[model samples]
Target: MDATLFSLYFSALVAVYLLPGPDMALVVATGASRGVRMALVTSLGIALSRGMHVFMSGLGLAALMAAHPVLLDVVRWGGAAYLLFLAWQVLRADMRVDTTQGAEGSAASGFTRGLLTNLLNPKALMFCGLFLPQFVAPERGPVLLQFVWLGAILVAVGFAFDAIYAVLAARLSRRVRSASPFRKWLLPTVFVLLAGRLVAS
Candidate 1:
């Protein structure tokens, strides 16, 4: 990649990562509710999903989805439904009590939630398809190689941001009382809002 183009791409990536989105909301919620370990696991799941999106983009799945609007709607509705399910889970859980049956199981569920949350969103895949191509330069190297490099960078930067948010949220949660209504309701509210946003979009 050309040095200047790479710099520009990096700048754009940073800007995008800084924006508050569902992924950030999910990470922060998980951190605040369950603690840093679960949040980190969630972030890892999201990173894996992002990597898969990049791979699918490389295979031109984005174009396929664009050609088939029905497919996109299917993903969009599915994502929204999943978000609502997460919201329900949050609402029903008693955060004041340590009701978790097992740490390992809880972590697994968190990872699955994070992975599915991002993976089910058609917009995220479409974004990978659109954003990655803008930075690819055929003159600099093989196009596929350039895409791979760019995709790797995108996932790395995104994961870094998510990790930071997770840690900060976890630390903040420690200062607030566990019985606080705001602490209990925050994740559910965020999930519902995200679901609404996905449906609206």
Candidate 2:
């Protein structure tokens, strides 16, 4: 790929990652409420989802969904429903800051939440299909190879940002009381809003 084109792609990717979205909100919320460890685990799950999305895009799954709008709607609605379910789970969770138990279990749940959140969103897969192809130069190399390289970069950059958010939120969380209403309600609110956004989209 041309250096100028690669630079432009990187810039655009960074800009997109900087935007406030459900994935970022989830990581920050998890860090604030749970701790850095769980948040990092959640980020890992999201990274895996993004990798799968890229793989699916390379296999032309996005094009298949585009050809059948109902399939897209099914995925969109499913994602929204899952987000709402997560909101409910957050609302019902015990937020008493118990460090003695359920750490392992909660971390596993967090990973699943992060994975499903992105994986079910059809827009994410479509984004990989659309955003990646724009930067591909047919004459430079194999198109699939270019996509793989770009996808890896995208996942790496996204995970880096999420890790930053997790650390910052965990630091800030230390100052607040575990019993605070903010910790109790912030995550549920974020999840609800994300669900609404998906439904509206």
Candidate 3:
């Protein structure tokens, strides 16, 4: 890969990743409700999902999904349903346990939430198909290697930004711990809003 092309792609990737999106919202919301550890774990799941997207894109699955609107809708609906489940989890959490636990839900559940949130978003998959190709060079050695490298870059950038958001939201939550209702209601609200957005789209 040309150094200049990689640099340009990195710049664009940073801008794209910095924008507020589902992944960022998930990290921040999880952090605020659950604590930094859970939020970080969630980021791990999200990073891994980025790897899945890269793998899917390399296999031409993303393009295939883009070509077929029904397939994309299936994924989208599944994602929206998953988000609703998450909201239900938040709303139905044991208030006393949640207060004592400080959002330390199961790490596995957090991971699953992170994974599904990304995997379900057809836009992310489609974006992978559209975005990566712009920086790839067919004649610049093995195409698959370039795809993996670019995908890794995207994941790394996303993880870093999401982690920062998680930490910041967690810190803010700590300061506002006195705001009991906010602590109780925030995650469910965010999840519902996200689910609505997914459904609307």
Candidate 4:
């Protein structure tokens, strides 16, 4: 593995993960309703998903996808469409009591959603595709292994640190449950903003 690339990827992941974004919001939402366990599970899902993205990008899948102009267009549009759909769902979140046992259904879906979101994310593919090549050297132990290690670490660290964010968000969700006036406006607006971000990107 390339030590330098690993270090670079680690640092970049830390900076980017800490930024407020869809991933963070998802952590907050899951943690708020399902407790820390659920939040962690969701985080794991997201982490694994990111790993998949790195794998695909590093293994030439991303380039191959990009090679076919029609396929690239499909993926791009598909990702955008999914993001917009998620944005609407987030925006329309019910401020009323989360009376349902979300835990019953949230586990797999949370993980899957996290995974699929990253898999479909064009930004991730593009970033890794472009950035990874810069640090990769022929002397590296194994280029593929190096990429995997870098990507895996990035996701794992993200998972571990996100717990803190999830705890805070869950607490906030609890506190705000009774304040529909705040939730109705805040949550939906954030979703709309996230949607806009997806489109803009």
Candidate 5:
């Protein structure tokens, strides 16, 4: 097993999770108004959707790399470019928390929303395709297995961290309402750093 590769994947995953995104914000907002049960259900749906993405990416990447090995560089460069683009968007974005859309809904509805929200985002598929391939080494065993392992780690980590965010948002709804400007810039900075890391790696 490639411990070093796994470490890099883990670090990247953590950085990405830390950045403010629509999905995270939605989970937090849901938790704040709807409570833990819905938040968890929503998170489960999100996690499942991510798992589907990773599985599809694994299959597609493994096949493509097997046929066109040089495409590895393409995935790497593409991922880096995408990360840079995201960083630019974040940097230029207005960081305002919208807390007005957290109506209490059924667990099934929350799950469906979360699933559709993730599956509908083409960026998520692009992200998995780009990011997962970076850690795969042809010298290792089946590339598909490697992808599954790495993607599983990513999903597990993201779920845990997002769950914590849900609980915090729920417990501190009032404080979250009056959130400081620190988060606004902090997440953008993190995105910039992540983009740099993607390039440097």
Candidate 6:
């Protein structure tokens, strides 16, 4: 990749990554409640999912779906439903797990959860197919090689920002530990927004 093109793409991607999202929230929440080590592990999970998406994109799965309009619509709608399901799950669960009040629930394997969550998002797969072409120059090198490099670049950038978010959330959530009621109300809102985005697009 050309240095100038890589810088431009990197800047745009960083801007997008900085925006609020579930992945970021989870990282922050997990880190605050657990620790940085757990948060870093979760970031690795998200990166693994990104790697899988890159593999899928290279196989032409993303592009081939674009050729079939009906299939694309089905994917879009199905993704919307999944997002809503996630939203519902968030709403139904008790947000606050009081570590101070009682024995905490068993520690979740956050890394695996993060990886599975990202891999399952069809919109993310579509975005990968769409976003990469803007920065890639076929003449720069072999197409697959370029694709792999760009995917790695994006994942690295995203991982760094997610860690930052984790630290910030950890710092902020410390004053209040018994706000599960509020968190319960707040977290579902994100999933609902994600679902709306899917439906609107």
TM-score against truth, every candidate: 0.92, 0.92, 0.92, 0.75, 0.64, 0.73
Q: After superposition, how far is residue 147 of candidate 1 from its true place, in Å?
A: 1.9
Alpha carbon RMSD to native, model 1: 1.9
Which runs in model 5 stand beyond 4 Å of their true positions? 61-105, 174-201
Looking at model 3, the pairs that clash are 34-103
Give the better candidate number (3 or 5) by TM-score.
3
For model 4, what is the error of residue 119's alpha carbon versus the real structure, in angstroms, after optimal superposition?
1.8
lDDT of 1 by residue, 1-201 (tens): 667888999999899989988899999988887788888999999999999999999999999999999999999999999999988987888653355567777778889989999999898999999999888767778988877888899999999999999999999988877545577787788788889999999
**C-alpha lDDT of all candidate models, in order:** 0.88, 0.88, 0.85, 0.68, 0.68, 0.71
Higher-scoring candidate on TM-score, 1 or 6 = 1
Q: How many backbone clashes does candidate 6 have?
A: 1
Q: How many backbone clashes does candidate 2 have?
A: 0
lDDT of 3 by residue, 100-199 (tens): 4444457777888898888888888888998998888889888999999999999999999989999999899889858756776777788888889988
TM-score of 3: 0.92
Please give, for residues 7-97, the per-residue lDDT of candidate 2 as tens digits: 9988998898899887899999888877888889999999999999999998999999999999999998999999888889778877544
Clash count (model 5, backbone only): 0
Deviation of model 3 at 201, angstroms: 1.6
Flag regions of model 1 displaced more than 4 Å: 96-100
Model 2, position 129: C-alpha lDDT score = 89
Q: Candidate 4's residue-wise lDDT over 16-47, tens digit each?
A: 88887777876776566556666777787878
Give me the overall lDDT of model 1.
0.88
Model 6: lowest-lDDT 10 consecutive positions: 101-110
List residue ranges in candidate 3 displaced over 4 A.
95-105
Q: Please estimate how well model 3 matches the true structure, expressed as its whole-model Cα lDDT.
A: 0.85
Ranking by TM-score: 3, 1, 2, 4, 6, 5
